[model samples]
Target: MSADNRIIRVIKGRRPKVVVIGGGTGLPVIVKSLHEQNADVTAIVTVADDGGSSGIIRDYINVVPPGDIRNVLAALSDLPSLYLDIFQYRFNSKDAFFAGHAIGNLIIAALSEMKGGIFDAVQQLSQMLKVDGHVYPASNTPLTLNAEFTDGTTLSGEAEITGAGKHIQRVFVTESDLNAKEPPQAVNQVIDAIMNADVVVLGPGSLFTSILPNLMISNLGDAVKATKAEIIYIVNIMTQKGETEHFTDADHVRVLNRHLGEDFVDTVLVNIAPVPSDYLDHQKYDEYLVPVEHDYQGLRDLGCRVISADFLQLRNHGVFHDGDKVATEILNLAFQVGTMKKRRY
Candidate 1:
């Protein structure tokens, strides 16, 4: 049966604690659907974003970028739709001073200052926004994403790395400070979430920039490796430019495994549907390259239980994962594995 057609239901009085790790546009959709399914959700977002409004805000405020966290907060929030619309509203380019800044980003930046850190600021905002579940920054501090290209050149910052237009060897992150070489540390609460979760999910975001930055953190990656929870990866439906261009689904899994130094992903959800020819608007959806190719044998070689499904949703000429279908499948996996899978740390 297709994942969407699967008639899975959660038992009463039982909430499967699910921890989602990643950043960028795709993270919120999954979180919202899981929240609707009554799963206890915790989002661990990457802090390495340095582009557009987020980069501008990060430059001036010296706080962890709030864009990803803001989106996740809105997604899992129980607030009225009108309230969230106001929070998500953005200034037009004509308004040069505040152009492109979401009201929610400004609020998060303010709270970060008042709360003495982005982590605490998010906690405060989560309560105020009536967020349905926990939202933790991958690390309490700002992290700079750096990439080494195939030609042996290095670029720092998300924009530069992607804009370099070269094949990537690998990507890593570090504290934005000039003197720091160590990976930014994830907060203890994030580690606790992974260890206590019944399942941990990665991706449907930029494999290197959006997803890997979180896992690149030493403590967080270590916790993910050690956790007893089922490790699931929701592979992106389309390849991203400058990273994962022409990357097969198996190549995506391989990069993730190489970074963490283990075949840590227990399961992978791959989209089997096809995008129509020339369906994407290059001007509007410039970041996407093409549909990701499949390699079931390679995934099996990596020891992943590959779950293929028609999880594609096309809107505004852009491709996105069908959140409801993906969520149902994940909850089914959680139930299949049973709730007793949480590590006894």
Candidate 2:
């Protein structure tokens, strides 16, 4: 169905509940678009980040990395643009102690300290920012992402794993706290959102670091696999050199299924539009190597419904998914799922 018709249908019924799971710049783009579509959006942000200001904060404060959560908050916030700009502001290198730190990250760190937990801190800040949707941290505490590479060597930390430059065999999460014996798990709200969602979306972010960190949390992955929500994977526009070099779209889905022990993805959104030659500024996006290759049959063999389209958006010499187009497709699928549920009753 057309996006216009889907929008009309959605308006005549209850808003679709969408739960987007991932981290990085790509996630906020989709979350913001879903919020614009009037979907009841919930973002389950990865807390395994251990780089930049977030890493600094994690080392010093021993709290969840606030970078991704801060961006997701800005995306869903109904606050004025100026306020968001200030919240998102980064200190210059000259500002020694605060250099590279975002204002929102500091605020989140402070709140996490005062509120006694990152999840509670984010929720309190959400209300203050007049956020239009929920933003839940993947865990209450910091998580260290661990990877076992094809060479059988293991690495801990998201930064270390990515920098190792090895073909990853599989990845998992562990509590950053050495003293903590318990396994990592998402808070109840995150699991509830997944189970109750009309649609659950993953990716447009790093396959291992960004998306899978949350799923590596045992119960959260179980909820996703067992949930009735139509799971959608937005295949990345380009394969990353260190992570998924020479990977096809089906290879992406394959890795996801292998990790979770099930072929749980219901739909795969692949970008068919070709990027203009010489348009990409490689220095700015050094990690991305080449456009991901297509393998439709492989995807189908894994029980995925492929939806390839012109979902590409080229801007400022960077390639990205067109947020509006992707959101439209998501909403259409969500509405279809909703309709089917109603008919069954």
Candidate 3:
């Protein structure tokens, strides 16, 4: 059904529909928390990844990079810890052929080949994993991330763009081939989820590579702009190198607005908790530069109702958004929107 005619059936006392869009370590944390909270969650993950296990799998076989999807599945899966551990298990260096590949990636790759598409593969796997929520790849095919540096030089591939450590002007998605000028399109379900959702979320991931690439698709970007759903941006807790160094919370919102060609962000989640000097282990978390600065006035100028709190969690010396805290805030926003919608009737 077309978005215009599609019916959103809200059963009495049913969970609010929350669609989370992004890729990276943070995405799963928020999704898992939402699942536990009984929200009708849908995760739209990036397929532009070209690093580590995902990169290797995408290179060997023309399949969507499965690293982010694998993580998301594990997070929402209701399986036993031991079963998940086996799926997440990696091969030792002694196993040359399969070394460093996570078992889940292989399974996803195999399923992708069998199903003839990553989207279908993920759906089939979701059923077997007993996932509580839906997980959708932003694109059906592997996508290459292309970035333009502030100096006007352009680069292709997530690894190259990020490894260069240059200030990025913007990043967009394209077909995996470098020669392709057109971007791979997001599937209908992704658009439907965004339009039909009670609340739509973007990032706590890399602003350029992880979140923006998904929004770059023409149809997907258009749907996001047109969706009446309350769009919430979960800003990163820390600035990332080669992406948003020295960026404030407002800068993140500004970039998002610029990418989508308008200010669509209704709510902005900012972490006000301070990171102690030298708190992060640089060797372990090299990509993180510093805690993202707060610019309350700037966020206000963008017409976003800012929710600043101690959404910070420290684990293994790495700073992260407290999943439960963030999820609670998201649910509150969703409920508030729902309440307002009902009162307007």
Candidate 4:
């Protein structure tokens, strides 16, 4: 097809979508950038967190923790204004009922209760945020992540599993054998996004804990593989000490393949720049911020195209990506390069 014809085709009939699969703070970072870049982003967030606010919500109120979902919402909230600001606020009074609670989390939990389902709750909030894209819990049911340790002991929840300090032999959900009702909005939206998407991006976040948890759900792994969209795996800039201690770029992929299988990913976006060794002094081996000694060639040999760049965010008031810079790269990947996936062009 001619360039004009291709562009016309893309504009006329194309979805030019992006389906991001993961959870934790990083997924929203990707979502924020891509939403700005104008990819019809559909975030399939992991619902397996059994920690902190989310864990409390799940155990006490029998609802999915709104923390990560709230993060995704805030990230995609239309920039510089009321929606984002109101949702991102945390209560201050220690004696207050809302103390230590995020307004977003409260909103989502309330919506879930009124709407009578997690999916509807998210929809209600998304409409309010005017978020640039869609967000869904990977599963509708509040899920418990079950991890089997190398020592043959099984941890019952995500927080417990991660906190147990054991080498995870394999991780799976409690009702793995049960057929889950896919959050209708989530399942259909993700499938539809995939069929029309120009790119599907995964990770730069926690490996087993965050990313794979989503890929394991809603039959999402199968849907992703079935899509015609180019797939890109963005590698994390630093190693997460306890979860990814002494890991390299290749180790990340290795873990992905181990759970989801070897052919699960196509391309990996890696940071090629050298960080000052002084940065390493802060990255203790005790807390999951060890060095990410990347093996680019190994990933390439594994059939993943390693797209290199200076993909790091400088230190700031908050410890995360500079949104504008990351958004620039996201725009390039989605609109400029189309994709770096080897099979696409």
Candidate 5:
């Protein structure tokens, strides 16, 4: 080979770019792992959450969901525990004020109100935390998540939607055709990151609420489909009681295809390792871990590569997806596909 050709190849073999979309702990695990792989990462988080501490702040102070955003930021935190712990600290007081709110959530709320925009507040927080990657709201619009059942029952709000006692036949926002304004300018940065990315990750969270909600956005989905990047959907290890109910791996993919298209997700990550029966949380969660969906064969048949890994984790309060293990699988996938321009070792 020529000397100039070798220099060009060495220069081009730099770190990869990654974009992650979704809420909950799942996407954070992937982000933490990918961050270590020396990839340029962007996390486009969902703003539709309207429950728990996030809901309280959203209602009283009027801001995008901060709980999920905080979780993601913690996962991306590279510095010592001092800063991260302070941000995550919760005031446990008998007083009516600051009872259950995390200091991080309130900090975001205060900045958001002070700055007059949720996206701007998140950027400021990101800088304060010195988070490893860029994080942005999927959309700046304050949205109410709507769920419609097969029987035609309609539910509004994330809390009520989870308790409908019926399978979510379809999920959409109240103003589906709102001509919803473009996603926050920060999101376009995520898209631009994707344009330069080798691969993008979709989920390992709630299939409908966490993953699909972002894609349902008019412009976000368009950017994803148009990007020259490979997209992967990290399937969940267990199905939620009222949410997925009895969803299989194939059912999850079908739901994705329904939203984006048949070829929307390039690869589907599955858990092939045997989960210990003792890991099941029937007593607390009141539901069994739904078996891995039988759609692995079908996914491979349909032209999507199905990569299996040990993606399960046992935690006391949390559900599934061990952060480090899930991150390892993601790095494995990225390296296997040459999507991440980094050495695995």
Candidate 6:
């Protein structure tokens, strides 16, 4: 083990159990960094996706969308680079039948059909891929995201909700299968992970579509509220156009608290470093708007312990959280919490 890993083990007497809840491109970046730090990570991925290759597959096969899950699996997999490349490879547009589909998404779809559910399929594939940690879809079945805009109009499906271009008032999830008797609920293992985790993380993903879908599952959200784990919200560096335009960091926290019906977030990680003006390629990343403005007092009023720092990383003319830096802060917080529990006992 590396010195840092050794120190964590020695201090905590075990690997810190971290449950990261979210989906989209940002979730995997942080997951990969936490794996490098030797934290026992469990990624609770959102399955409310209804876009891109995942949308096509879901429409045809009646299965949970696999794009987000596939990315998270790649982040945690210990397979060779060549193997991962092949798995993540997307077919060219000229290949009419397979165009825009990722190899991993196809594999996941096949596995889900064979295994009878997404949870089992992902677990089986995790072993096959030599994944370093656990990956659990927020629910056992497909979930459709529903949103009520500020104008009081409602929409269903993640794609439709996002494309409406209206201010989202609130978001919720429902089973895509209207005939299903039971409401959407996470599996036992997912609940166990949340209840037993040392820290539970939310965000660095879209506030309405990516993060809230998972939490809107009643059982999962309840577990998060009741868990002894210190809940942390990784505030987005930039405001998203269709979702969080003109939103401050406090607005993000406020929305989360409102959705969950409590001020459950114990801490917030705010990126204080400003994005350079006219630096972003707007054509490439049209979804992101301006940098999220700060509201320290507003955050404090929400009962959040705000940690502000230079957590900015500028790459390819886009701004993002420096995963390594964010991971370090998370581990430090986990260590402190673990030590306190040990001392009290």
Best by lDDT: 2
Residue pairs with backbone atoms closer than 3 Å in model 3 (clashes): none
| Displacement of the residue 157 alpha carbon in candidate 6, Å | 1.5
In model 4, pairs of residues that clash are 240-288, 241-288, 241-289, 242-288
- The candidate with the higher lDDT, 3 or 5, is 3
Instruction: Please give, for residues 1-345, the per-residue lDDT of candidate 6 as tens digits.
Output: 232343344244679989999999999999988888888999999999999999999999989999999999998888888999998999997877799999999999999999999999999999988888899999989999999999999999877887788999999998999999888999999999998888899967999999999999999999999888889999999999879999999999999999999989989999999899989988898898899999999999998999999999989988888998999888888887866642111
- For candidate 2, the TM-score is 0.95
Give lDDT tens digits, candidate 1, residues 1-345: 222343445534567889999999999999988888778899999999998788899989898899999999998888888999999999887777798999999999999999888999999999998987899999888999989888999999898998898999888888997776665899899999999888899977999899999998999999999999999999999899988898999999999999999888899999999899778887798999889999999999999999999999999998999999999899999887764564433
By lDDT, the better pick of 4 and 6 is 6
Every candidate's lDDT: 0.89, 0.91, 0.88, 0.69, 0.72, 0.91
- With candidate 4 superimposed using the best TM-score fit, by how many Å does residue 217's alpha carbon deviate from the native? 1.6
Runs in model 5 lying further than 4 Å from the true structure? 1-11, 174-187, 286-289, 317-319, 335-345
| Count of clashing pairs, candidate 4 | 4
What shift in Å separates residue 108 of candidate 1 from its native position after superposition?
0.4
Candidate 2 at 73: error in angstroms? 0.4
lDDT of 5 at 124: 85
Pairs of colliding residues, candidate 5: 249-293
Q: Cα miss at 307, model 3 (Å)?
A: 0.2
Ranking by lDDT: 2, 6, 1, 3, 5, 4
Per-prediction TM-score, please? 0.94, 0.95, 0.93, 0.85, 0.87, 0.96
Q: What is the per-residue lDDT of model 5 for residues 1-345, given as tens digits with 9 covering 90 to 100?
A: 111222111114755566888997677777776676555678888888887788888888657879888888877767678888888888889788788889989888888888887788888888887777788877765666888888889987877877767888878754322575643232466567666666778887887788877887766777777776677888887777667877878778778877776466778878876666666667776644565665777677656778777776767733576655655555556556554342221
165-279, model 2: which lDDT tens digit per residue? 8999999999989899899988999999998888899987999999999899999999999888899999999999779999999999999999999889999999999988799
